[model samples]
Target: MAILPEPVTLSLICILVMMCVKILMDQTKKNKYHFPPGPRPLPLIGNMHILDIKRQDYTFMELAKTYGTFFTFHFGRAKAVVLIGYEANQEALVKANYDFGDRAPMPIADDFQKNHGVIFSNGETWKITRRFTLSILRDLGMGKRPIEERIINELQYLNALIGSHNGKPFNEKVFYNATPNITFSILFGRRFDYDNPNYKKMIGIIDDVVKLTGQPEAKYYNVFPIIKYFFKTPGLVVKRVNELNEVLHEMFKEAQEAKTEDSFRTYSEAFLQKQEREKATETTEKIFTEKNLLASTFDLMVGGTETTSSTLKWAILLMMKYPDVQKKVHDEIENVIGLERPPKWEDHKVLPYCLAVMHEVQRFGNILQYLPHSTPTDVSFRGYTIPKGTIVVPLFSSVLYDETKWEDPRGFNPNHFLDANGKFLKRDEFFAFSKGRRVCAGETLARMELFMFFTGMLQKFSFTPPPGVKKEDLDLTADPFFIMRPKRYYVIATPTI
Candidate 1:
């Protein structure tokens, strides 16, 4: 190679020196907006080793004790700032909601194409789907007579099922099927017989899917997208996804064949009809297509099914533990609506203690741990700069159990929802349905289902602990996932005398 001229060499040296200086400046630039503090992390893996997926709650609670409520953590290369107390949660979730509310598009969820669905979608798609879903739900009888009639029918069938027990020590799980079955019926405009094999398989798939969500390996795949391309072995998460997809496709195919334009037979039909009409007109894109329909229906089935059912299960368990509270609820029902008539939705207004128990059950259950969202654009919050696209997690669980807000945060107490005069009280801080623009779209439907199914069941049966088991023996351990539910156990459902 020929030697460079003196002038050219000087110019080349200047360029290289400038590049070095620029990089040095960038490295030294302080991230003025610091994330919440947490345990010191290692390089590459960050705080990955500290997490125990199977017992995530215990680990996180312990971590909170050491690191305080507001803390920072890292998984792989991604940094997460966790808000752990009521104040931090409220400040981040409500006050600076615009900075927070967007769900992070994790890789495994993206592989399942969940980012397009309302539950997982971010930005414009979420906003549009959320608005449309709420409107359609109202039209399809979420808080209307149609849904009310369905709940009453379900209660009638369950009353008969409980009658069949003949005061024997029957396991409550058998009767619990009615709750999820009714939810499915409302969603698909069809119900599965309790003995149906397909229905059993579907329930099993849903349970597995929920369990896999809290798996460390599954989380690892999300944090590191490249792992999926290279792996040849079938992952547990992949199998769960396949099972869910099959169920969704079958349901959608049936809905499509039965759909009509004039009447709203089902939620899916209403969406399909709208999609067909929209197709005729020139459109930028089709948001109401079959894929979105399938995903949305599946989202509803997942969101509505497990949460309310689990809460009901926990309520029964808690009532068994606190006999005095359960007795008070039963006495109130007897005083307001006699044993001959079933507890109707209208009676909820008059029965203060019963309503408080329901609210307390949901509050104590605390299904969602961290409701994840992402920033649509750059936002400033509490003197910190929240960059665009940063994943903002709303720690709803922390808020529900905050010591300052609750009288006995660690204990299960229905009195938390009661006032000085023994009337049912409602607080804005009770963000179980969440708040702001990204709050749950199915709040009304959830409320209706919880009230109808819960009061209906309580009226017909008395929940009691199994033989040789004390109320204190019941397990309160919750499994970590998208929803936090109690560990599996059997209970005795005895008929009320």
Candidate 2:
């Protein structure tokens, strides 16, 4: 055995002492603060050994059963405070919104967005961009008759495409192409033909981005960012995002050339006008920039398209699974609007059963389990002193599936949104679009699309399982994507008229 030099030996001893002191200080600070209790975590990995990364929402709910609604969960060295149940999520998201409203940083999204967009950005950027977006959407007829007319018109194209199937079994993915056109019309002032190459390319890129974002490898990158050097998913995500940005830039150029001082025709035009105004003003901070335009547009295009389309797909699947419920919707549509006339947004008011079914689909489908939020400052929440920048996840699945809130929490029953007298009963517990200040920016438009598209489809056609497949054989299990998308299945749409 060889002996080390005295200087090197002393240096090694000093390093060990310093590490010990640092650990002691950290433990002391943790003890001083009343942090929420959680399961024991091992060094470096935290609670990853115990967690199911794919179905983290389910794992969080199970842990909540033991640790109560508020608990600390660790992903590697990072700390996340999980808020479960309606009361806890409501209190944090609504009551203490300012304290818990920041978007939690995820490695892949941060790398791509860089805090530029509405969905993942924080502080002033989030506030200004979100406010601007809502205003633009409102001005462009988000909840008004203008948008309703657009949806009704788009329905003609969608009906034609679906009718082309001629009662033959077709993959539900076809809805992806149709549903996004509603969003495109709002964003660019025109809709693309279903077969246009650019339209197909854009949707394909968005779908790839969504699928990659939901993969386990992407989640691992969030926990261990260093893995990006070895992993291909993160790099692929950035490449796809850049491709999307290229498509958006072309539209931006068109919007700039088409801009006018008289009136705002599209979302892109309004944003360009705002960008110019910010540039002209010397004193004010320029919230609207070229990068922001790309980020905001990306957020709107992706967020607006995927979730609405996925929900519509689920609605059709559920209708096929339960023909009795489909019959009720069909009967309601026949009574209110009949077979000859097209279903309008106004018809939803008189169609209570149809309205209930729509709400139930959102609740039962549960496409987005939860989007993580963060604390902007150190704050006391329910007797726990959560530190600043702590990742906070308000588990939406818990609220949606709370046994205390719903009589049939695990079952698919439309009565959850219906009163005994057969009217649409709005439940406060439905967090499908999330809650509070960070609630989905596109909620109103989604409601319009869902009601109009869903009712219109039922009016023209009845959805059923393919030839030999029984309703019981139809799988309700969501695909392993970041969003809870229904797995690929074939549906037969027979024209009722």
lDDT values of the candidates? 0.73, 0.89
Q: Which candidate wins on lDDT?
A: 2
* Tens digit of per-residue lDDT, candidate 1, span 413-444: 88898899988898766868877666777777
Which residue pairs in candidate 1 have backbone atoms (N, alpha carbon, C) closer than 3 angstroms, thus clashing?
Answer: 102-373, 102-374, 103-374
Best by TM-score: 2
lDDT of 1: 0.73
TM-score for candidate 1, please give it: 0.90
Please give the distance, in angstroms, between residue 31's alpha carbon in candidate 2 and its true position after superposition. 4.7
| Global local distance difference test of model 2 | 0.89
Q: Which stretches of candidate 1 lie over 4 Å from their true place?
A: 1-33, 52-69, 170-172, 225-234
